[model samples]
Target: MTKINAFTYQPLTIPSHTESVSKQNQKPNAQKSSFSESLEEEYEKLPLKLSKHARERIDERDIHISQTEWNLIHSKMQEAKKMGINDSLVLTKDAALVVNMPNQTVITAMGLEEANTRIFSNINGTIVINH
Candidate 1:
C-alpha cells in the first residue's frame, strides 16, 4: 500500500473579505428565539370544542357581613329598644342580641343599674361602637 502525506491532502486557505456579507446573511438564533420569544404565530390553533356544564353546581352559601353592617344592625337594635319595645330580639347572620324587659322582681333581685349594664354589654366583633 502506498502512503500519501496528510498535509498534501489539505487545500490552500483563501483570505476573502466576507465579514460584512457573512454578518448580513447570519440566520436569527432560531432555536433560542423560538423558546424565549412571545411570538403567538408559532403555536398551533386550538380545535373547536364543546363547553361542558360544571359537574358540581355552586352551593348557595351564606355570605359574611362587614364591620359597617355589624354597626348598623347594632344601632338599629338599640334604636328599636329605646322606643319602648319590651324583650325585643335582633337576629343577625353572625350575631344575635336580646334585650330583657325591666321586670320589677328581677330589678329587686339583682339591682337596676347592674342588670342594665349586664343586658347592654352583649356586643360582638373586635371593633367597639361609640354608642
Candidate 2:
C-alpha cells in the first residue's frame, strides 16, 4: 500500500502593512454598536422612564426621537423638575412632547406642524426649544 503525507492546506491571505499606529490613531471605545445601549445609559443616569401609554402613543403616532433630541428633552425636564413642574409642555421645532417630569415619562407626542396654533393648558411650565 502506498503511503502519502497527511494533507494540511493553508489558505493564502495577503499580509496587510497596517501598523500598531493604526490602533493608537483609533479612539478607545469610539463606536457604539446600537442605539439601545446609549439610550439605556441615559435612562440609567436619569430617574426617568417612559410610560406604557406614552410608548404606545409614540408608536401609534410614528414619532421618532434622535439622541440629540432626547438629550435636549432631558435637560429641559431637569429644569422643569427643579421648578416644581409636574406635567410639562415641551415644544421643539419638530415635536410637541408632553412629559410627566415627576413620573419621568412622556405622556404623549404630536408633530409640531399639527400642534401649531393649538393651545395647551394645565401645564405648570412650557419649554420652547429653539433650533
Candidate 3:
C-alpha cells in the first residue's frame, strides 16, 4: 500500500545480480519479524527460568477434594455414564439449593443439566437413600 510520489526520480538502471554476496550481507530491519519470531532478536525474550518456575508453581497448587464430596461426585459421574450423556447434555432446570440446603453446592460443575440432576430430588426434605 505504499504511495509513490509522481515527482520522484526514475528507477536505477544497473542490471540486478541475483548471486551478489554483498547484497545478501545487508542486515534486515529488526522491527518487522513475524509474531512467532524467537525472542533472541530483542531484550523482551522470556528468561529460561520463567517457564520452568511456572510449571513448578502449577504442580504445587494441584488440589484434592474431601472424601465425602468425592463420593457424591463419583455417584453423579456414574449416573451420567448410565444415561450415555456427554458434556452437551441439556437440563430443563437450574441446579440450585436455595431454602434449606443453601450451604450445599454441586460437587462437579460440568454441564448445566448435569448440575441440576446432581442437586435436585423428586422427594423433598432429607435425602433417604436405600442403598
Candidate 4:
C-alpha cells in the first residue's frame, strides 16, 4: 500500500516508442560496417596484384591514382563481381584501369587523356566512377 500525499511525490516510469526503433536502426548499421570491414580486411590480405605489363604502362603513362581513387576502384570491383563481370574497364576521373576480377589483378592503367583517345575492347564490363 502507498499514501498519495503523506510522502514525497513519485512518478510512473515509461519507455519511449522511439527507443526500440532507434536501437533496431543502430544494430543493422553496426552489422553492415563490421561486415564490410571484415571483407576489406580479407581483401587486403589477398594481394590485388598488378601485372608487370600493367606496371610498365603505369610508369610509361605517368598515371597516378590517389588513395581515394584506389578505394573507389576497390569498391567498384566488388560491385562488378555481383554483376557477373570478369574483365572490367574502369573509367575514373583521373585514370582508366583494366582489372581481372577473379584474380583481383590490375591488367593495365592509363590516364584519362590516353583512355579517351583509345578504344577499349575485349572487356566484359565497364565501370565509371567519380574519383
Residue 125 accuracy (lDDT) in model 1 = 20
- 87-113 in candidate 2: lDDT tens per residue? 888888778888888777887778788
Worst 10 residues of 2 by lDDT: 27-36
> TM-score of model 3 relative to the true fold?
0.21
lDDT (Cα, tens digit) per residue for candidate 4, span 1-131: 45677875657657578788889989988999998788456435534667778877876887777666777787889889889999999988878899999988999999988788998888899999973
Candidate 4 accuracy as TM-score: 0.61
Off by over 4 Å in 1: 1-65, 100-131
Q: In model 4, what are the clashing residue pairs, if there are any?
A: none
lDDT of 3 by residue, 1-131 (tens): 33477555566566567458455644353333442255323212211111333233323433222344335533543454455433222121222111112212222223233344464433233221122
lDDT of 4 at 51: 78
TM-score rank order: 4, 2, 1, 3
Off by over 4 Å in 4: 1-47
Tell me, by lDDT, which candidate is best: 4
Model 4 gets an lDDT of: 0.82
Model 3 worst lDDT run, 10 consecutive residues? 95-104
State model 3's lDDT: 0.32
Which regions of candidate 3 deviate over 4 angstroms? 1-59, 86-131
lDDT of 1 by residue, 1-131 (tens): 33377444555566585786666556466555765444223212211111111101101122233446545644654555466644444344443333333320011112223334555443232222232
